[model samples]
Target: MILEIQNLHKVYNNGTHALKGVSFSVKEGEFLVVIGLSGSGKSTLLRSINRLIEPTSGTVRFLGKDITHIKGEELRKIKSQIGMVFQQFNLIKRRSVLSNVINGKLGSLGTFNSIIEKYSDEVYKEAYNCLDIVGIGDKAKVRSDSLSGGQQQRVAIARSLMQNPKLLLADEPVASLDPATSNSIMQYFERINKDFGTTVICNLHFLSLVRRYATRVIALKAGEIIYEGAPSDINEAWFKTIYGEEAEEVEIR
Candidate 1:
């Protein structure tokens, strides 16, 4: 297993218990999708894996190393091996696409050099290669905001790739795009997962997309895991269980 999470819990200052006692394991190279209703702690669970939102309790092991509470440079080293893509795309709108992608290496690049954007030739090449992997090498010099929503998300994926992460966490990556655009963006992630053998854990709203892209599916509700199985195994009864009886599954196709 590449990731092993045990009894993870998170509570906010407002007394909201986001994660009750989540536990799961991810094998290397699996495209794992997290499904849930709004406020189901899907985002919290993903963030906790990378320590973006520190878990209130429990343990996280990545590649057999405990990362539940590692600090300082130790954490940074681990972070460099994990990449995150967010719903908003999180690009510097005014910056060049190449600039945004190269920024993924900021953890490795010293603070002074990264802040000044004084990247070496090797760094530039790596950034360009990542953009190429996402099919945006030609857009390197363009400002990030000039691209369409799908394109911007692709840039975000490319940025994450510059970290050369073995694991990628995507939080509602295509939530803002149209269905067609969303599929295109997801295909890029598929390519990354297949070609590079990267383990992916993504939070998705649409079950259709989850079925299409995920090798394994995990459903969360009220901060607890309610379902864990193959995407094709989520039958009508299981769907209602995960989505609630009052809810209806809307087909994106």
Candidate 2:
């Protein structure tokens, strides 16, 4: 398993129970999508994988190593193996796309060198290569904020690829894009999984987009997994089980 999340639970200091006994495993080259409403714990689940949000209980073992209890340098080193993308693009608005992409490798570089912007030629080359893979190579010199929502998300994807991670976690990656652009971005994610053997886990609000891209789907509600199965086996009834009366409120198409 690329990732093994066993009996995971997270409760915030403020007493918000984010995840409850969540358990799942992700395989190499798999494209998995998580669907849930705003407060359903999808973001928490994905962030917990990289320890951006630590679990209060349970083990998260990656490549046969338990990373849950590890801290400091050890934790940072392990987290570098996982890449994360977010809904907001999260790019430095003042920086060029290439600069933001290169920042992905900062975790692997010495602090002073990284802080001083002294990236090696190899790092720069790899950053540009990732941009090419994400179909944004031509925008390398442009400011990240100057791009459209879809293009900025692509730049963020390229930034994640620069880390050379084994697993990719995206939290509402295309939430800000239009339908057509969202489809294209999801296709790029699929291509990354198929061609690079990268494990992808994305949190999405769109059931149709999830069905179109994910091989496996996980549905969460009130911090619990209400459904877990192949995409083909999921339907409106399953959504109702997860969403209840609010099921009708969501626009899946």
Candidate 3:
């Protein structure tokens, strides 16, 4: 197993219970999709795994190490090994795509040094390679904000790959895009999972994308795991059970 979560739980300061003893294991190179309604602890769950939002109580074991409370350099080390993609497509708008991708090593290079550092030819090559992987090698010299929404998201993915992370966490990665663009953005993740052997744990709201891209599915409701199985197994009865009886199925395409 690449990751193991044993009896995880989280509660916010506002007194809302976010995650209720959620536990699951992930194998290496598996594309696992998380499905749930808004405020169902999907975002919280992803943040907790990377320690962006600490869990109220639980164990997050990655590569056989318990990373629930590690701090300082240790925490930074673990985080550097994990890449995260946000719904907002986090990127330095004023910077070039190549520069943003090179920033992926900021953690290892130290923030202070990164600001003044001069990258070598090898570093530039790697950044261009990452751009090529996302089908945006030609956009490297362009300002990040100048790219289209889908293209900007691709730049973010390229930046994440510069770290050569063992695992990638995508939180509502394509929620802001159109149906066609949503699938296009998702294909990059699928390619990364297959070609680079990176384990992906993505939070997705669209069942269509989940069925098309996810190898396995886990559904959450009110911070609890309601279902776990193959995407093909999410039949009509199971849909209502996961999304509630009154919820209507909406296809993206």
Candidate 4:
């Protein structure tokens, strides 16, 4: 297994219980999609995996190492191997697309190099390659804010790729996008998972996209896992169970 979360729990400072004893394992190269209504802990769960949000309790083991509380350089080292893409395309808006992509490697590059913006030729080459993978190499010189939302998201994906992450965590990556743009963005993720054998854990709202892109599905409700199975197995009964009795499935495509 690439990642193991055993009895993970996260209670916020405001006394909100975001994740309640959540546990799961992810094998290498699996496209794992997390589905749930808002406030159901999907984002919390993903963020906890990468230590972006510290778990209140429980263990998070990555590649056999328990990283729940490791600190300093050890924590930094672990973070370098895990890439994160947020709902908002969190790019440096004023910077060039290439510059934003290169920033992904800042964790690996020492403070001096990052401060000086002294990226090596190899770094530039890798950034370009990542942009190419997402079908936006030509936009390297463009200002990040100048690109359309879909293109900006592509840059975000490329930025994460520069980390050379073994595990990529996407938190509602397509939530801000339109239906067609959402599918296009998801296809890029699929390509990355397939071509690079990267493990992906994505939080999504749309069952249509989940069924189409996910190799496996896990549903959360009230900060708990209500269902875990194949996308096809999430039948009508399971849908209502996950989303609630009054909920209706919304198709994106």
Candidate 5:
């Protein structure tokens, strides 16, 4: 297993319990997708793996190591193995795409650098290679703000790839794009998972998108996982079971 989330629980300061004893395992190179409505804790689950949103309790293991117990330098070392992408591109708007992508190497770089633009040639080559993988090698010199939403998201994906991550976590990665662009971005993820054997875990609200891209689907509602199975096994009945009253509110494509 590349990622093991065991008996995880998270309770926010505002008295909202985001996760409730959720446990799951992600094998290396697997493409797993999580589906849920807004505020259903899907993002929380993904972020918890990177400790971006610390779990209130329970252990998260990455390749048999307990990351939950590791802190400070040890934790930073463990984090460098994971890469995350968000719905928002999260790129430095004023920076060139190459500059933003190079930021991925900061975790591995020593304190000798005062500025990120001074990234070593080796890291620069890696960033360029990642851009090529994402079909955006030509955009390396372009400022991030000049790119479209899909292009910007691709830059975000490239940024994650620059990290040489063992695992990729995408939180609503296509929510901001049109259907065609969303499909294109999803295809990129699928290709990356197939070609590079990068374990991919993504959160999405579109059932159709999940069916199209995910090998496995996990559904969450009210901080609880209501369904976990292959994408083909998902149906209206399963959606009803998970969404209940909200089933009518859900508009599946």
Candidate 6:
């Protein structure tokens, strides 16, 4: 397994119980999609996995090592092997696209080199290669804030790829995109997952996209896993159970 979560729980200081004893395991190279409504703890679960939110309780094991409580260098080392893409592009707006992508490897570049922005030749090559993977190599010199939403998102994916991660976590990555752009963005993720053999754990709202891309699906409701199976098995009854009786499935395409 590439990732293992055992009884993971997260209760914010505001008394918001986000994740309630969630447990699951992800195999290497599996494209797993997490589905749920707003406030279902999907974001919390992804953030907790990367220790971004700091889970209140339970354990997270990545590559056979417990990383729930590790700090400083240990945590940094583990995080370097796991890349994350968020709903927002999260790029350095004023910087060039290539610069933004190169920042992904800053964690491993040592404090002095990163502070000086003294990237090596190999790093630049890799950044361009990553951009090419996302089909945005030609936009390397353009300002990030000047690109369209979809283009900026492509830059974000390229940035994440610079980590050479074994596992990639995407929290509603295509949420802000239109239907067509969303599909295109998803295709990039699919390509990365298939060609690079990277494990993917993505949070999504559209069942159509999930069924089209995911190898396995996990439905979350109020911080709990209501269903876990192949996307094809999410029948109408199961959909209502997962999304509530009043909820109707919405297709992206």
| C-alpha lDDT values of all predictions | 0.94, 0.89, 0.93, 0.94, 0.88, 0.94
* Native-structure RMSD, model 5: 1.7
In candidate 4, which residue ranges exceed 4 Å CA deviation?
Answer: none
TM-score of each: 0.98, 0.96, 0.97, 0.99, 0.95, 0.98
Worst 10 residues of 2 by lDDT: 244-253
If candidate 6 were superposed on the true structure by all CA atoms, what would the RMSD be?
Answer: 0.8
Shift of residue 2 alpha carbon in model 2, Å: 1.2
lDDT (10s digit) by residue, model 5, range 165-201: 8999999999999888988999999998999999999
Clashing pairs in 5: none
- Residue-level lDDT tens digits of model 6 in 133-213: 988899999999999999999999998899999999999999998999999999999999999999999999899999999
Judging by TM-score, tell me the better candidate of 1 and 3. 1
Please estimate how well model 3 matches the true structure, expressed as its whole-model Cα lDDT.
0.93
Candidate 4: C-alpha lDDT:
0.94
Q: Which 10 residues in a row give candidate 5 its minimum summed lDDT?
A: 244-253
Q: Which residue runs of candidate 5 sit more than 4 Å off their true CA positions?
A: 114-116, 246-253
Q: For residues 130-219, what per-residue lDDT tens digits would candidate 4 score against the true structure? A: 999999999999999999999999999999999999999999999999999999999999999999999999999999999999999999
Clashing pairs in model 1, backbone N/Cα/C closer than 3 A? none
Q: Where in model 6 is the C-alpha error above 4 Å?
A: none
Model 2: lDDT to the true structure: 0.89
TM-score of 2: 0.96
In model 3, the worst 10-residue window by lDDT is 105-114
In model 2, which residue pairs have backbone atoms overlapping below 3 Å? none
lDDT of 1 by residue, 1-253 (tens): 9999999999998999999999999999999999989899999999899988788999999999999999989999999999999999999999999999998998899988887778899999999999988888999999999999999999999999999999999999999999999998899899999999999999999999999999999999999999999999998998898888998888996
On lDDT, who's better, 1 or 2? 1
